[model samples]
Target: MGLVRLVVILIIAWLIYSTTRRWLASLDQKWDQKKSGRSEKIETMVSCAYCGLHVPQNEALQAQGKYYCSSEHQKRAESS
Candidate 1:
């Protein structure tokens, strides 16, 4: 009876350990998938026409066929 109780406890412990290991493995796999799935492309860079500062083209302010680092610079350039 004592041996049977020990065997049951061991089985229960093994089940818990295996379940936790599987859950952690799945979480790790999901994290890798999320990182790889992003696959973000490199953005083109443009220089600010006013200050010659480099910024990503998508983030730069464009006016009169020129790119500026900020709106203030763009406004100043346009006003002049």
Candidate 2:
């Protein structure tokens, strides 16, 4: 009886340890993916043609083979 109880306890302990380890590893993978996504977002930025300012690609104005922070800057660059 004593041996059977010890074996059961050890099996339960091993199961708990394995489950916790897998959970932690999954959380770590999610964190790494989130960090890489943030880096990609930073890398997707564009520089303004008029003043060399960095702006997000979605917000920057694209025209005439150049990027600008605003439409006014795009017109200025085109006029000049």
Candidate 3:
């Protein structure tokens, strides 16, 4: 009888441990997804026509329908 009780207790303990581990793992995965989702935006990248350097479109300078990394590049492109 004592042996049976010990076996049952060990089974219960293992079940509880496994359940807790799975729950914690799921929580961790959800946190990672939430954290990554914050910066998961697709930005439009444009290349500077003068030097072929790529930059995010929102931060690039636009002149004559061409993208530039800086004003100097834009002026040089316009001159050339």
10 residues in a row with least lDDT, candidate 1: 35-44
TM-score for model 3? 0.50
Model 1 CA RMSD to the hidden true structure, in angstroms: 4.9
C-alpha lDDT of residue 50 in model 1: 91
lDDT of 2: 0.94
lDDT of 2 at 3: 100
**Best by the TM-score measure:** 2
lDDT of 3 by residue, 1-80 (tens): 99999999999999999999999999999999987765553347899999999987878999989999999999999998
- 2 versus 3: better TM-score goes to: 2
Count: clashes, candidate 2? 0
Q: List the residue pairs that clash in candidate 1.
A: none
Runs in model 2 lying further than 4 Å from the true structure:
none
Q: Where does candidate 3 have its weakest 10-residue lDDT segment?
A: 35-44
Error of 3 at 10 (Å): 0.1
Which candidate has the highest lDDT of all? Answer: 2
lDDT of 3: 0.91
The lDDT values for all models are 0.89, 0.94, 0.91
Error in Å for residue 11 of model 2 = 0.4
Report the lDDT of model 2 for residue 52: 95
Error of 1 at 40 (Å): 4.0
